[model samples]
Every structure is written in structure tokens, then in C-alpha cells.
Target: MKKRKTLLLPLARQFTVILILFTLCTVCITIYSTFGYSRLQTSFLNNSLESYSAQLAKSTREAYESYENICYSIAYSQVVQNYLMSENRGKSYENYRQLENQLSNTALLNPYIIDIAVYGQDSTFASLCGSASNYEEFSRSLSDSRFPYRSAGVATVNRTLCHVLAMPIYSLGTGESRYLGILFLAIDVNNLLGNSLKSDENDYDPRILFTDASGQLIYGEPQLYDALCREEDRSDVFQIQETSDNPVTYAVTGYSIPGIEHTLYVLIDKSQITRQVARISGRQLLVMCAITFLALLFLFLLYRPLIRSLKQLTDFMNTISSGDRRAMKEGAVIHQGLIGSKEISEISTAFNDMLIETEKLNHTIFDTYTRMYELENNNRKTEIAFLRSQINPHFLYNTLTMICGLAAEGMDDKIISVTGALSRIFRYSIKGSDMVTLEEEMSIVRSYLMIQKERFEDRFTVRYEFSEDSHDCLIPKMVIQPLVENAIVHGLEKSLEPGELLIGAGRNPEHGYLAIWIFDTGVGMPESRLTELRESIHRSVYNKTGDASADLEDLNSQNHESIGILNVNSRMVLYYGTDYTLLIDSEEGVGTNIQIRVPYRLKSDTNARAAQNTNSKGENHVPGNCD
Candidate 1:
């Protein structure tokens, strides 16, 4: 009694929920089971219906075989095959009549047979249904006389469907003896197929129909054809469907006869069979409901603890959904990691880490964006100053030409050589354009040495070593001129004894750039002055001025006409960036080596034509002056 009381306490708590669920389940099961059972029963009845129809078709096929046999027997008869092989034609009527009588008797045994006919080769004589007749009636309808037999559907004397089966009778004799006649048989079409329906004893409703290759009706009543036609969803076979009318469930089956071109269909209605099964299903559902109610009560009692745990997890998830992260942190301690157990401790730890990491990443992204904005402003100002310093090649060319002419007419080999060097230098300047060919820039430097050689005469000597491959490469016009100027004005120009200048141009494939170095065996600056020049060239060109800070009031103010080493340095850095630049290699008294590394193809050479037009705006070229 104590055990029974404990079970009853749980049953009472789940009574309402289980009752509602049990009622809904019972109704659904009744509906589903009844539908499934009805379908199964209807399928069985359709199989039976198809079986009966197949048996009828087999019987009809046998009847057709019997009719064909009679025709074959006549075709191979000794007298008929002999007459057909001879030239007598129908002159031997008495013998032909005997064969006809035997064939007529054979056909009479076939219930579906309606008539028979025989025709001579010339179509002069014939017999039909045991009566003498002329061939005039079917002469036009006959096709070939050489083959054994042929058949066709035609109207009978009684106005009904019939198939005419005919065979060519050949004479049995020597070659080309004679020509005989043909034997024909008529079979009623409907009666031949209707034999299958007579064997079924069930109350199943059925419809019979015939159609051509296309799904158009050929025979049967109009209403019956339409009813069966609606269910013919496929061309290869038939379909079954539920209906509200008599014979509630219906299915259709179709087959094409082997020798015949027409298709036959048999539609059966088996609703009464499905209805009986539905009644049985309703009783089975009642028994299942009684057993299910007791099992559900026991399961509900056993799952009480699990249900409470699920409610606690659901409440924590709801707190997270409401944007209460603080509450979620506190709840994790109370719940002790998923249902007060060890199952989800890892998931709880991972989720908390993801939230905190996302917040930290957002702060880092904001700080980086602020830094980029400040850097961009400084870069824009420097870019403007670099672009302003690009010089005009044509103006430089005109000025050098004037200087060359003034020094040309003297006999002093010194003066003449200097003037010739001046001429070559001006010519080389024009060749520079925006992208002086490497060959042309080198020629200009050689001319510069020639002029210096005449001025210093035996005091200094210049030599060049350049790779053969560097001739066609394009670099900025006047790119090497600035470095050479620095070496002459600051290094070799101060030397007391004979000084040496060496220019080297070659490719450093390892660095992917062409390096041109100007080395002078002259006074070299200290490391401190070198550092100062390097820093000045690297500073943002935007704030640079033409005045040196030592000679001006405002050292930081921007300036025009400041075409120093810094100007060339800023332009090079702007276009090629940090990749290509000038490197100063020097030691006190030994020499100053200025190495300029540049890309094989400079950006200025690519825009040479445009750069020439822009830089030549303020100057015009004049013709040569003769004195």
C-alpha cells in the first residue's frame, strides 16, 4: 500500500499534461493509421484486378493464335501451294473449294471469328464465309501477295470491330509452276478482349478502354473514357487515386500488345476493400492509447530532476539575451557549470574569454586608426614640395649652349677644349629630356670631366667604368649631376695636389637596382658633417627653405629656390620611396664615394614628355650665335 501511494503521487501531478497529450495523440494516430491501412488494402485489390485482366488478355491471345493456325494450315496445303506454283490460276476451282470447306470448318470452332475469304492470284475468283464471290470487294485493300500473311482492322458486315487476317497460298511444285490465291480470316475485336472480364467474381468496379500510341481514346463509352483518362498520369503505366464517387478508390493499368499498335487499359475501383480495413484500425488505436497513458505517467516521475536542471539553464540563457553580462557572471558561480555538474565547464570558460577578448580588440583598432590619420597629413605636405623641384631640361640646354659659344673662338688649346666640352655638355643636356637614356647621362658626365680637365689641366684626372648592359636603361634627367656636383664643389675642389675622380655605373642584380658611384680622391668630410647632411635630406621637405638655417631668421619656414642635395633626395624618396636612395661612403683624405641606387626604369622617364612640357614653361631655346 505504501508503494502504491508513492506511484499515485507522481500520476496526479502529470495527469493534466498527459491527458491532453494522450487525447491529441490518439486522434492523430487514428487518422494516420486509418489512412495507411486503407492505402495498403487498396493496393492489394488493384493487384488482384490487374491479375484478372492479365488472364483475360492471355486467353484472347490464345484465340488469336488459333485463328492464325487455321490460316497457316491453308497456306501450306498441298493442293493450294501446288496451284499457286503452277500457271493454272483459278481454273482449278473444285480443288480450291475443298480447301475452303476445310478452312471454314476450322474457323467455325473459334467463337470470336466472324468470316473468312480466299482470293486467286489474278483476282478472278473468291469465296467468303462458305459462299462463292468475286475479288472485286477487297482487291484495292490488299497490299503484297508475296509475303505469308497480313492483318488489318475493318468494319464487319454487322457493323462491329474486327481484325482481318490473311495469308498468301503458294503452290507446292517445281519452280514457277503456277499462282494460286490468298486465304483470309476475320476476328471480332471486342469479343477477343472481353473474355478476360468474365472470370472476375469480386464486386470490384472496372473500366476497359483502348487508345492509340498517343493517349487519346479510341473506344469505350464517353463517361467511362473520361473517368479513366483522368488517372492516366504516365504514358508508360497507370496511376491509382482516391475518389468520392462509387467504387471509392480507383487505379488504372495500361499495356501495349506485342503485334498490335494500340494500347489497352483496365481501371479498377476498390474502395469497399479499404473501408473494411479502416474499421479494424480504429479498434487497434483504442488498445494502444490505454497502454501509452500508463507508460507516460512513469516516465514523467522519473524525469523530475532533469526537468528542473533544464529550467535553470534556460533562465541563465535568458539573462544573457537581456544584455546582463554582470548577471551572467554571477549566475555561473551559482549554477556551477551547466546543471550543477562537470559537463559544460569548458563551454562556460570559452564563452567568457571570447567576450572579453572582443572588447580588447575593439580598443586596439581605434587607437591604430588615430595614428594613421596623423601620419597621412604629414605625408601630403612633403609630396607637394618634392614635385616642385623637378627641373626643366630644355632651359638648362639653352643656357649651356650660350656659355659654349662665348668660349669657342680662342687658340689656347685649353680654352678650345673647355669650349668643346661645354658644347658636348649642352648637347647631352637636350638628349636627357625627362628620361635621359643611361648612355646619354653618362656622355654628359664625360663632357663635364672634359671641361674640368681643361680648367685644372694635369692637376686632376677622371675615369669611368660602366657595364655594357646599362646603356638603354632609363633614369631621371640630371639624376647623377647632383652627386657629381657635390663631389666637385665639396670634395675635389678643395684638394691642393693633383686629385682623381672615378665614376662607376653597374647593375647589382642582388639588390634589383642600378648603382652609379662617384668616387673622388680628395678631401672628405668628418662623420659629424656627413650625418648632418644625411639628416637634412631625410627631413620632410615640406618645411624646407632656400636659406640655410645659419644664415636666416626662421630656419623652419618653407622656401623656394632651394635646389640643393635635399631637393633631389626628396624627389627620389617620393617616387621610389625608401627602396632606392643615395649612400655616402667616405674616409678622411682617401676619397668621398657617393653611390646612388635607382630602379632600372624611373617614374620620371615614364612621364618624360609631360615632365618636359611642365618644366620648360618659363624658358625658350634660341638659335646658335656666330661671331
Candidate 2:
């Protein structure tokens, strides 16, 4: 018998290769079409700019010619020539009136002509239609000109920007053409060029500019003229790429007027072309996506049987890998009875068997992990409780010793006060919850400070600063009192002068954390001892093991003076992690500042508990008040 060939796998490989090639070809075609379309659009824009610039140049030339003809007619008219050639031109009213009439009639040819004037050779002059304040200057400029028949450039006339046109007048009826005077016409630039440059289309904003032979702006925006002059190539048409200051790109074209020394430029915004290309490219991309989708659909139909079986297996494996406990417990397996190929049937059978074995192993591992997590959590809680217990005894021993000293002196009133305050401290510390509101915490701190005041007498005073908003923020119990006790014993007791103990509680606006600080103005420790104490506290926080109670015992044996601060640091780290640990700063002569920072949290039943605690105590809680 002849060996049979399997065509399914090879056919699938070929289909993949075809899809990849199709994708590459589609990308190449899109890129080529976009590039070609951009170039075509740019060319079309350049041509449009060129045609528009020519139209502007034509309109500007016509305006110039019309104004020049008016000057020529006024300069050569018999009435104006007679006025300039007369012996006494300014003195004769009839001559002035006739001369003014001729100039006025000639200016009527163009409404843009704002002023007309004629100067005589003997310092005599006549004006019509506008001011003649600068007629003498105009005449002198013309007479001193290298070319008397040319324009005198632009000037301001009657507070309006105008183009000055000068034409020389000679004595009529004379054998020799003798110089008589000059005729001046002040033409309004805005009225002349404004209509010609206004664009009718709204797609692109076009800017028209006119510059003289020396590149100075004759009319229009000086900025556009300056940009045109900066171009290295003086081509008739070019593009100004987008700039930082001016985000709009422009296609610029220049045209020289037929009868003047001025060049006109038309700048059309090129963003319109970019928008057009983007729209075209978008359409092309849509069509390509549709074609690709149809092709993929056809391929999927051709290989539906093979793909369907593989997809089922893939989905089941994904469910198991994603740790879906419900699916694993239900023992969902792929039934291979529907599979047509022997190889796929074998794969389905092996996968089903492997899933059964994996489910069993998964349960065993999960049970072990759960047990480990529970044991670790319980150990951490026990360690924190043991740390809290350590603080109560250390504090009570000091208070009891002070009470004994007071009894020896026979101070009955002071002894009563100390015992009462100690009673309040004991009640507050022996509460069930490890967390309490900051208001309750500060209340206990006040009782502790009151007892210290009785023992020290005039040796130290207490000051309290607390924000009202931080009264209800939750913090670990017995955290602040230990630091306060430490400061009194180690810091204030050694000082001879009267010292001040500052206890403050507030919310840190920067970190949104509750802050409690104890500061003492007494003798401080040296840097060496401060470093050693800080290292010991941090080591206790990091070296926690399964047995935190044992760790606390080891910490207590190392340092006597630092036990209170170390106990506070370790408890905070255990309850709130290392981020809420205590920060200690001290100087040899300045004293110590121990600050505790904890996240701002409030217990859900804080109000109810607070009311209950207050009712039982028969008094309202007062924070930071010592009498």
C-alpha cells in the first residue's frame, strides 16, 4: 500500500504566509499612495499660489497706473501750468481757484487719491481735495531726485498711510522746457489694495503683500515681506515650512508688477493640503481594513474544523492556567469522541488526563499556602501584643518609684494628685482595642504629663499644641505615652534649669498622615549615642521572625534607656509596616525630638465608642490640658 500524505498542517502554514504577505503589500500600497498624493497636492497648491499672485500683481499695477495718470493730467493741465509759471501765483484768487478746480477734477478719476498739490518755481503753491502742509517738502524731494518722474515712496498723509506719486511740471508755451514745479498725489493704500487681496474662499487664508525694489514693504504686512526677503532662493514660487513662532505653513509665489518696481506675494496656508491628504489616507485605510477582514474570514472558513478543535483546547488550558478554582473542581475535560484526526484525538486525551492530575496537585499546594499565611499572621499579632505589654510595666515602675519618693516627703496633696492621674493612665492603657482615636490618646498623654509635673515640680513645665481636625484620627495605643515618659526620665531629669516639654498632635498636610511629636528642652545625647540608638531601633523592626515575643525579650535585654522608643518603633512597624515608624532627632545641647507618623484612619464605630467611654468615665475627654 502507498503511504498517505497529511495536507492540513502544510495548508495552514501556506495560509499564514499568504496573510503576512497580504498585510505587507497593503502597507506598501498605502504608503506609496499617500506619498504620491501629498506631492500632487503640494504641486496643485503651488500653482494656485502662482496664479493668485499674478492676479494681485495685475490689480496693483492698474491702481498704480490710474493714480499716475491723475498726477500727469494735473501736472500738464493748462490751468496748473499757468499757476506755476505766473509771476504772482499765490496772490491771485482767480488763479488759485482755477488751479484748485483742475487738480480736484483730475483727482475725481480715482476715489483713492486723498490729496493733490502743485508747487511753483518761485516758492508759490496751490492745493485741492486735501492738506498741503508738506507740499514744499514734496517739491524739494522731487527737485532733488535722481529721477524726477518716479514715485517718492510711501508716506503718511492726513494721518492715513498713502503712497506718494510725484510728476514734474514744466512751463508751457515756452521754447525751452523750463522747470516750473512738481505735482503730488497722496493715494490711500488701504482703499487701493484691500479689495484686491481679500480672499473669497474660506478653505485657506491667503496673505497678500507688496514690497519695493529694495525689499522694503510698500503695502501690506511687514512681517510677510521680511519672511519673503529671508528666503535664500528668489524663485517665483516656493514653500515656507512651518515654524515655531508661526505654526501655519505657507506656499509662497512672487510676481513683479508690469509698470512698477514692486513685487507682490501670495501666501496660502498649506495646512489645507495636509488635511486633504489625511482625509484621503483615512479612506484608503478603511478600504484596506475591509479587504483584510474579508480575506481573514475566508481563510477561517477554509480551516474551521482544525481551528475549532485547537481553540477548544486552548480555552480549557487558559482557564486552568488562570487559577479558576471552580473550573478545576468541576473537572471539565475535552471529549475527544468528536475529533476526526488521530493526532488531535491523542492530544485531547493526554490534555484531559494531565488536567485531572494537575487539579489534585493544585489543591494540595493551596492548602499548604493557606496554613502558612494564617500562622505567620497570628505570630505577628502576638509579637505586637507582647511589645505593648512591655511598655506598661516600664512606665508603671517609674510612676511607682516617684510615688514612693513622694510618700517619704509626706506630701499628701501631691501624692493624691499623682495617684489619680496614674489611675486614668492605667484605665486608658488596659483597653481591649490596639487602636484608639488621637483624642483619647492625647488625653492619656495629658495624665502622664500631669504626674511628671507633680514629681519634677518647678524643674519643668508642659505645653500642648494639637489641631482640632486630628482629634479622631486612629493610631496605635500606648505609642505616644512611652516616648513622653522617656523624654521626662532621660531628657528633663538631668537638666538643672527649668525646662519645657512640648507635646503636639496634628495632621501632616504634605503626606496626609497623623503626626505626634514630643520635644524636650533639656540636655540631649551625643551623635555617637544617637546613632547607636537609631540603629538598634531599626534592627528590631527588620529582624522580626516567626516568634516576635522572643524578639521583644531580646530587645529589652540590650538597652535600658532606649527600651521605650524601641518598643514603640517595633509595635508601629508590626501594625502598620515600616513606613509608619518613629523618627528620632537629638543634639548634645539642644534636646531630643521624637516624631511618630501614621496614616490618617478613623474607626467606623469611633463615635459610639467615644460616647460610651465618656459616659462610663463621667467626664469629657480633654487633650493636652494639664493643671
Off-target runs (Cα >4 Å) in candidate 1 are: 1-37, 79-93, 124-138, 146-148, 158-160, 177-179, 210-252, 260-262, 268-627
Query: Where in model 2 is the C-alpha error above 4 Å?
Result: 1-304, 317-326, 330-358, 391-398, 405-411, 604-627
For candidate 1, write residues 1-627 as lDDT tens digits: 555534444433565576677768876876687678667766766677778778655665565567667777766776555444445546566666665676567666877777666666765344445333322354455545565454543445345556566666666556674446677676676776655566546665566776644455555556656656565454323334334543344455666644444567766544445554555566666666665666666655544444454455556668878878676445542244333434445555655676567557756887887776566544533443333333334334643564455457544565566567766755554543455677778777777666555445687788888897677677766667656756766677788878888888888788778888889888887787767666665563344343332222232232232233555565565557776666776788788887777877644566796678877853654456221
Measured on C-alpha atoms, candidate 2 has an lDDT of 0.76
| Per-residue lDDT of candidate 2, residues 494-545 (tens digit) | 8887888999888878887888899999899999999999889878878766
Best by lDDT: 2
C-alpha TM-score for every candidate: 0.34, 0.47
lDDT value, residue 170 of candidate 1: 61
